[model samples]
Target: MSMSTLLAIMGLLLSAIPAATFLRNLPLFLFQPCKANHAGNVKVSVLIPARNEEESITECVESVLKSRNVEIEVVVLDDHSADATADRVAEIAASDSRVRCVNGKPLPENWNGKQYACYQLAAEAGFHWLLFLDADVRLSDTAVSNLVQRMQRTNVALLSSFPHQETGTILEKLLIPLMHYVLLGFLPFARMRMSKSPAYAAGCGQLFLTKKGDYKSAGTHEAIRSSRHDGLKLPRIYRKANLATDVIDGSDLARCRMYRSGGEVIRGLLKNATEGIASPVLIVPFSMLFIGANVVPIVALVLAIIAKSTLGIVVATAAVFVSLLPRVMAARSLKQPWIGVVLHSLSIVIFIAIQWIALAQQLIGRRTAWRGRVS
Candidate 1:
């Protein structure tokens, strides 16, 4: 086979792998596991680890207070913020009996700040079910109630869901939606649901639900104290302890604008990179798959047209279709911007670039800092 034909074949195969996974997982991704017939009577402690979240603290607390059909107490652990995060929580506490603000203890040696705050919050919680929610995430009125119902029904030890990512800037539109694409495209939802293996464990740290007893037994945040990416870490910890961890659809139930600007988005992703796809073992393989599947086909298609290679054109066209369709479907289902659909390939290029950059930083012993803390 000609080199052009060989490249086209490679692209077609690589693109089809993720396309198949996306198709198989699309229904599971879009399904609202939070919507159910039974209203939750479960009492849950909604724990928020706040550091410099003054702007969103009130809104986050108020939204949780709006949760219906469930008994919930909102606990905001102020992680020694430079802002008015504690004051805002205190104001809410004064008005509402269910809301309380607690000052977080000093960071322990080798512990990630957020993880320590969560450990403290878990200690203060006065309920059987504990929910570790991010301060920026705003839950719908029925979100907590329905989430509990689903967790109880499934009998999973830990449950998490990716909230609706609200993006406004051009860079945000291009980058944030890739989270869903990477997740639904690569991770097999069926295997994740059927196994307690740490290999299949996946979650979102923004929202985690677990029974208090299970969390204590699993060692919770203390087990992964130094790790920044709790989404993957916490789930693996649970699975390693012979417990099941599952991810559900939260796009309809909660919304969060993770980063305010493009710079923040880059830094935030960099901070999360080491524990995810940016490691030495995973980076090269992912780089090959990402470039082969998304970039090669488009370039080969144009070259084939220029050279009039019919075989190259046929396989390259199939590759392009298979690679692009998953993004289109995800955009529609997740309510992502249309811009991501038009520039899917470029987005992958930038996404992979960030991963490699993160890996380089990790190797050199340089750490990315966030919220006045270094990781």
Candidate 2:
């Protein structure tokens, strides 16, 4: 309303530029999938933890086997899938020994399903390196070799990659990029690998590559067996163990569509959003900030224009554009649709709401399901 407040708003808007620049390196892979290639002979135990991914398991297994040059022993954990997921993996495994389907043991007391399943898989695996992949992920031909080479180049114990999403539905298009953008802002790629902070470690669940020993030394899930978000925990654990770790933008090397429909997308996000956010106290503040940053700017600009507050209108418009630009760039880089940026940028509202919903669920002692397992 006044000159001082308008100037203050402008200053806050301008401050985002430096954050954008610092976070600019996050979209590490613009044309990443095309860059995949086999490095050398490195045996990798490609592990998949499938619960009820029957629809996607067939293609996922096929994609893993289609790799060009790399020794791979694919282990798909049938984590008590009630659906035809186990049958599907069995059928694939029956045809090829390279792709073996292993039944995940029941969730033992005090252990999370994924962690227990992974622990079993690791115990059964006889390989030099381990690669943990989600059942929805479809890999490129040279994905393994490329990851190994990147692993070798970085001299790190763990090399994680953020795969691109294959946005088929409207829901997938809107929400998935929000996941990555928050990850980008919350923990910038350059800073995570460069610094040794465990809080900053981020790995895509779709792709987690690490030396077998490094995995074991980090106590694997034994350290955070209770964690619902391994992607958030593993890299940090590895870093704390004095093992070098790095993450790459794998938009090209791997692709996945996490949920089938909008309702499913909302539930999928709610399952972990509250647990995944920084803290309980930050919940409301973050939600309000999210809404204010995205929706307020546009509404404020319109109101300012009607009220004839020239500086207010100009500042609001500039803030909205500046806030949305990097995320638009992120969506484009991730191969999400052009118009998806609008939803992706506006997603901060949905993001905060889902998180609160998740927190409410957790408090009620209700377990969330993903791929048919309690998350």
Q: List RMSD in Å for every model shown.
A: 1.3, 2.7
Total residue pair clashes for candidate 1: 0
TM-scores for every predicted model: 0.97, 0.91
Error of 2 at 197 (Å): 1.5
Which lDDT tens digits does candidate 2 get at residues 244-315? 777777776888777778878887777656556734877876665556556566666666777778788678
Name every residue pair that clashes in candidate 1: none
Superposition error at 58 for model 1 (Å):
1.0
Best by TM-score: 1
lDDT of 1 by residue, 172-274 (tens): 9999988888888899999888989999978898999999999987888999999999999999999999998888779888999998899998999999797
Cα distance off (Å), candidate 1, residue 215: 0.4
After superposing all C-alphas onto the true structure, candidate 2 shows an RMSD in angstroms of 2.7
